[model samples]
Target: MKDQGRSPRKRTGGRRRPNHKKKKHELGREPTETQVGDQKLKVVDSRGNTQKVRAVTTDVASVADGAETVEATIENVVENPSNPNYARRNIITKGAIVETSEGEARVTSRPGQDGQVNAVLVE
Candidate 1:
């Protein structure tokens, strides 16, 4: 498991130990891959009755350009700075450049958490 805690070091070579162990809320979850296919969504239970959304497969994207926002068919992932494999797998994530029916757009929303892909046109 990954440790999601602050580092034990200061800027001037000082040591700062952790105050407490990792909490349940600090646990990291597996990344969701929003690929092209039939729509499939997964609901994950959180602290309370609230749920988290995980997109398994998605075929559409909401592309916004200036004053207009339109739904477009996702063609493919053009580039993904987060992970190259994500581009090959067509996983949708924030900052990912995707090709849509309208044009190339930069994803601005977290699809794994939002359960939907929202992007802004790149020109």
Candidate 2:
């Protein structure tokens, strides 16, 4: 008697944790990009969609000269130990320079925090 719609959480309930981490091709050799607060990334969303989105930092700005592609330069990243969105605490971070389809933006993330990241600045 189960409804037909997809459930909010994964359907499998018994054994939750998977054995290994499934890494995507884009996320290069770094445990997680959350440490680099503001870094814009060119991302392909769930449905194979591509967009140049901002990282969650102050150092990046989308190129406004009608550029087809987006780019961002990285400066530094800082973590807010008191961030409520974080697991034990919350988090805040910033990036250097960034460009994207929606212009460009800085981005940041915290482990065991909210469900997703925060895209701060964009051009």
Which predicted model would earn the best TM-score? 1
TM-score of each: 0.85, 0.21
lDDT of 1 by residue, 27-112 (tens): 77887877877678999887667998888888789999999999998888999999999899888889999999989999998888
Look at candidate 1 and tell me the lDDT of residue 92: 81
Q: Model 1 scores what on Cα lDDT?
A: 0.87
Residue 17, candidate 1: how far off, in angstroms?
Answer: 4.0
Q: Name the top lDDT candidate.
A: 1
Tell me the tens digit of each residue's lDDT in model 2 across 1-123.
222323345666644444444445434332223433444343334324643343332333233344443344433333333443432221233332233344334444432122234344543
The deviation in Å at residue 87 for candidate 2 is 13
Model 2 TM-score relative to the real fold: 0.21
